[model samples]
Target: MKERWELMDDSKIVQLYWDRNEQALTATSDKYGNYCITIAKNILGNKEDAEECVNDTYMRAWNSLPPHRPNILSTYLGKITRNLSFNLYKRNTADKRGGGEVPVVLDEIVDLVSDTDDVEKEIDRRELVKAIDDFLGKLPADKRSIFICRYWYFDSISNIASRFGMTNNYVSVLLNRLRLKLHNYLLERGFEI
Candidate 1:
């Protein structure tokens, strides 16, 4: 029943997906649907677009599960929702500018790394990701979580402040400091920032 499926833990739900059971989809939606919708809505700024992105995320997960088993289901789902929402937001805003917390977040980090107009300056995405991962690993837990929440989840400063019980200005300051640290770290690692 629906209630029973809702009671299942993440690992069980993931197993159902691995087994190709139809109920896996239901369980995933039950567990992560709202979370995905929130991520999509934050980026796309429309309920309809968010819903579409969430649905697409489900489809993407279904297709990719056979070859990919995520250790953290929520993080995996959130990443998919965020990426899909970003792509949709980009296409919709091609004629205009995006208005929301998304723009604020982007503007804050835009200076950390310069735009790669020349193909020669483009680093392999995997290497860049590895460097970023190493940097995050070295950060204190609270700072790392704040950074992930702000950038990875596209969460607004006010929302992050509320969640972490910090003042909005404090959260903003922390994020700025983290960005500066990341920029210096990347530069020391020979990244073209």
Candidate 2:
């Protein structure tokens, strides 16, 4: 079935959400729920937490739509789910005094950059986003998904391997090669290394 929410205009969707129409909720879920869940599951690494995050995303969307006419509802909902999932993951890690896979993935990138400098200011965010889009678009779909799962989603190597039905060593090699390619691409674009 086609996504009803995507078929409707953003304003109508926003109004439906604001009115708390059950059909609207159903349509929204039908359209974006799986995407949101994937984003949350990739970050949280727990089905229960991901499910909770998806529900929370819908609730947050319902409450916020009246005042926030999001230009891209799917992206907005996905961002909310990802943030909530990450926060919950952080809380769980804090409780156990254990850092999770997501944190480790972020640390790999963090260690490559200077802390005090505003990296965003060095390169236009839009340009960087466009560059990333172009870079991913050039990859085969499977490799692109692998790249996104590893870096964009911050999934652990093992997790990505399992999800993609590959060996951990294979996932690691793929990511390392992709990282090197991306780094070279960025440098060639004159982004500060």
Candidate 3:
């Protein structure tokens, strides 16, 4: 059975925030806490840090709301959670070797992401996002899913293979091909390599 807070729709929850109701936090947590935590844990590979990131996400959401009402609440919260988790992961790994699938995931996409500061800024630019989105849109559904699973969700190769019923090697090879295609796609759109 779902709790009452869990039953409230996202609009109502957003309204609760706008209304200055503290129950807003409870409702948002009940609804998306686990989702955010999974995203955090996937990136950080630590249960405790994941939970902290989710909590910080709520705080950030609360602060950002009442003035900025997101069109898609889940995506908004998710972006916040993902960004916070990555920041935490960077901080935790700065002086030491980073653990878990995140570094592996990053390594796999190394060719796709730019390393130079200017190129990095270019990657974050909205036009680059649209180009990537366009490229993903043109890809076959399975390939797109593979790319999103490995990069966006940071799923391990074996896990992604299990999800898609492919051999792990097949998934790895497919991901490599997809990355090359995306790299070319971005380059063709006038983005810095």
Give the alpha carbon lDDT tens digit for every residue of 76-105 in model 1: 999998999988888888958454568888
Name the lDDT value of residue 95 in candidate 1.
55
Q: In what order do the candidates fall by TM-score, top score first?
A: 1, 3, 2
Which residue pairs of candidate 2 clash?
A: none
Q: Which stretches of candidate 1 lie over 4 Å from their true place?
A: 1-3, 95-98, 117-124
lDDT of 3 at 52: 94
Q: Assess each prediction's global lDDT (C-alpha) against the native.
A: 0.85, 0.76, 0.86
Model 3 misplacement above 4 A = 1-3, 115-124
lDDT of 2 by residue, 1-193 (tens): 6645656776677778778786677777877878887778777777788889899988888778777888888778877887888888888787874344677677655523332346765555556677778988999999999987777666778878998999999988887788778777867886665
The model with the greatest TM-score is 1
Clash count in backbone of candidate 3: 0
Which segments of candidate 2 are over 4 A away from where they belong?
A: 1-15, 26-38, 45-52, 66-75, 87-99, 111-124
| Candidate 3 local lDDT, 1-193, one digit each (tens) | 7559877889999999999899989999999998888788889888888899999999998998979999899899989999999999999899574455798987776766564668758656777788889999998898998888888877788889999999999999998888888888888877776
CA lDDT for candidate 1: 0.85
